[model samples]
Target: MSVDTFAPCIFRMRQTYVTDVVRMHLEIFIQPK
Candidate 1:
């Protein structure tokens, strides 16, 4: 694939990964003791 197309795909994947990590952290922090 061209770099133009490939770059956005990688960026999207990275965004999703970061979002998932943030969500997991929020869930852990919000859970009861």
Candidate 2:
């Protein structure tokens, strides 16, 4: 795999993980109120 394709693939996975964590945290914060 070339850097052109590989770098984006890695970035997408990280982005997905960060998005999921942010969403989960939002839900948890809402539950407290």
Candidate 3:
């Protein structure tokens, strides 16, 4: 649980979360009814 290792883990999780949010927004805009 060192800061060096933990920082990257947090960064990766944030990246994944942001990617999912962007994907969800794209899907909604691409198929607006």
Candidate 4:
């Protein structure tokens, strides 16, 4: 694959992974102890 196309693919994957992590952290913090 070309670098131009691959760069965006990697960025999107990283963005999604970060979003999932943030969501998990939010859920954990919002829960009562």
Query: lDDT of each structure?
Result: 0.98, 0.98, 0.98, 0.98
1-33, model 1: which lDDT tens digit per residue?
Answer: 999999999999999999999999999999965
Clashes in each model (backbone N, CA, C under 3 Å)?
0, 0, 0, 0
In model 2, residue pairs whose N, Cα or C atoms come closer than 3 Å (at least 3 residues apart or on different chains), thus clashing, are none
lDDT per residue for candidate 2 within 1-33, as digits (tens), equals 999999999999999999999999999999989
Worst ten-residue run, lDDT, model 4? 24-33
> What would the per-residue lDDT of candidate 4 be over residues 1-33, giving only the tens digit for each residue?
999999999999999999999999999999977
Error of 1 at 4 (Å): 0.6
Give the least accurate 10-residue stretch of model 2, judged by summed lDDT. Answer: 24-33
- Model 1 earns a TM-score of 0.88
TM-scores for all predictions: 0.88, 0.78, 0.88, 0.87
lDDT of 4: 0.98
Candidate RMSDs in Å, in order, are 1.0, 0.9, 1.1, 1.1
Cα-lDDT of candidate 3: 0.98
lDDT of 4 at 18: 100
Which pairs of residues have clashing backbones in candidate 3? none
